[model samples]
Target chain A: METLTIQGSPKTPTVEMDAKSGVIEIKGRSIPENSIDFYKPIVEWLDEYASSPSGETTVNIKLEYFNTSSSKCILDVFKKLELVYKKSGEKGVVINWFYEEDDEDMLEAGEDYQSILKIPFKMIELEE
Target chain B: MTFDIEAWYGEINKGDVIVNHKGVITNDLITEILSIVENKLIERKENTRIRKKIYNVMVEALQNLFHHTDKLPNETNDNFGEKFVTFVLKKEKEDKFSYISGNYILKSRVKFLKDRIDQIKYLTHEELQLLYKLILNNNEFSDKGGGGLGLVDIAKRTGNNFEYFFHENKKDHCFFCLKILITN
Candidate 1:
């Protein structure tokens, strides 16, 4: 219903979820000490958003770096969105994964998520 | 058998010392150390790719030390505080950096830790990537919210086997040392 916006910190990323726009963006670093605590609310928000049925949903993930713990939490976020995609006839959701020019690790991270999930991912490379 | 924390600390605090931290490890401390090291890497004019890799590896290393450090054995007479851990980041060469971290672990975990690392040591790059993805997708997280992917991520980025040692202490504790190198 309401937009969920979290400011980015030194150890966490900025998250924005807008129900009206059907867009979710998570950008910046995500290496929190307790990732589940940081991500729990966002996951819950996604759970709530899944029921509303947006016409189209776009997710953008542009992370410079994320720790292993955050990695799992991120996967959870994707899995939740995958459900949203499946429920919306499989064509209403697309994920835009952005990686810096030479960040092979980040690129591969996106690829890993793409392979594991059943959503369409557009690997967009950004020039540094 | 006894392990001397001070002696071991001194031995690893060699080379072009960049960041040498000891005593308690906390979330705020990790943030501060990462900021300091990131600034230092920038000052040294490291390329973006290497800088991010080192930063990523350092996060996992420090957090691993933060989460997995065992309480100091009662018999051990060391001034290192509870949940004590240490890490040294030093410049090994113009295009290389080394990160060495140490912490205590229960003797019971030695075999499991050893076997896990041994299994990761022999994996090729592609195999390591596959393993990392597999573990990432797995929902099994430790009570501390760790997905057990830290070591795999480290090995994958470094492209090097882990250089580690365990020194037995009195009672059921062992001091663990892990060394990782990042190069262009």
Candidate 2:
């Protein structure tokens, strides 16, 4: 499968999905006016990637801020990943949720997602 | 029982007005407003935590206003155009900022909107978090792509109850105003 890369904008995040390295990273802000439209393609890519499973998948989510709309879309992306993980015998998929040290809100957001999903999540704190 | 939108708008447009926009709301406009507010907050050397909270709340407030605003009738005397929304961001103190947004809604919808806000008003932070997660996990997004999580998220971030009002207008419409304050 071809890699999916979308450059970040002021209102959206940078997304990179590579099938070869089994790495998917979403960085920067995600406050798109129409989040579904922005994330639809990424979700589709993941669906395709789920077919030919990667040996080990590492997903990194580093976002400064995202609106409620994007939050739902992010969850959709995770749900797709969860499917992949379950099909892969629940061993090789991991999500790294990166947040600034002082951003209690981001930390809580990651925790919220962790509580909802069965996949493993690492809460990585960065220096402000 | 007509409400004076102009007067109410004037009341809120006071003290260090960072942004005062009143007209049609579009996606482009929302983007512009967010950037402007973000830059102003950064320029003031505001705390990063408070800045993100304010920005997040503004995104929800503006998008909610964009989605739920009622179009004005053609024959109305009110100059408020179709999809009219007015929002003001002002600095109330050194570390306090206020965001106020107003838009028209059909009178019939007031009860539902009121009930929703009232339900959120009494929720403690923990309750709000639980409600937020419940709604987020549910696949019941509105026709407008809203999962009904905006207000809850705003309340959770601010850790304060919502202060809202509905003023009746003559043409079977009411003006809904929501006020949120972010303090350091």
Candidate 3:
């Protein structure tokens, strides 16, 4: 039960996760200068957390932009969470993607991710 | 056959604007522009939501140019010399802001470009997402076949179709221009 936080740059987003609270939030842009470097630690943390994962894990993602490389990494993160969900069985993971009302791109981005990942993901629209 | 010198110069200058944008279009330029835009965004009292939208739109445009630009750097083969890509931020009469980018691309690629644009224009936002997923989940990206779903995302940036034009170059290339409008 711990917390991990990393700030995102012009290319990425700030990542904040609280193991005890079971709240994992990824917010901001995601065009990182080095996608592998920025995401390695986050993915590792998720891997570690998945071993003895908490109940009712909620992963919130609010990304404005990400490059093709970063998009791959995000998919990796979701895949990892999918593993966690399978392990937990019935009490699996819940994913929420927040996008502005007018931002059809981001909304569609959420849908794309939703279609690929096995976990339950809800697309939430926030007013600008 | 002699090269058309006037047409050559015109082609070179089609999208060339010699202005110092504090290096707004380079790897070094992104840092400065990001901070300035973030600041301007704060001053306008825009929340994180709107701010992120603007930020993503700008990044998509810049990276598209950075990765796709065909022109060489500082090679003065043409009369206008090696041209630089540009970003012009303007505030119009209705207090609207615009971010525009222009670059040179190979004439040989126009058909591919046109087909992609037309395909995206025909898909609904939801359909575009499904197509993007199918492509991302199945396709492999090669230098030759760049069959990624990124352009659909770019078209989604406007929540509508994008604007673009081409100017024939005297050389074997054409200057491709993309203009995106994100309304506040």
TM-score of each: 0.96, 0.96, 0.72
lDDT of 3 at B159: 61
Scoring only chain A, what TM-score does candidate 3 earn? 0.93
Q: What overall lDDT goes with each candidate model?
A: 0.90, 0.89, 0.68
DockQ for all models: 0.90, 0.75, 0.35
Cα misplacement distance, residue A105 of candidate 1 (Å)? 0.2
User: DockQ score for model 1, please?
Assistant: 0.90
The parts of candidate 3 lying over 4 Å away from their true place are A1-7, A16-23, A33-37, A44-56, A62-69, A98-108, A122-128, B1-24, B41-52, B73-83, B92-97, B139-147
lDDT of 2 by residue, B65-129 (tens): 98899887888735766798899999888878899988889999999999999899889999999
Docking class of 1: high
Give the per-residue lDDT digits (tens) of candidate 3, residues B72-110: 434434434444465655443232445566666778887
Local accuracy of candidate 2 as per-residue lDDT tens digits, A1-128: 99999999998899999999999999999987678889999999999999886999999999999988888999999999998899887677999999998899999999999999999999999997
Count of backbone collisions within predicted model 1: 0
Model 2: pairs clashing at backbone N, Cα or C within 3 Å: none
Model 2 chain A worst lDDT run, 10 consecutive residues: A83-92
Indicate whether candidate 2 or candidate 3 has the larger lDDT. Answer: 2
Candidate 1 error regions (>4 Å): B74-77
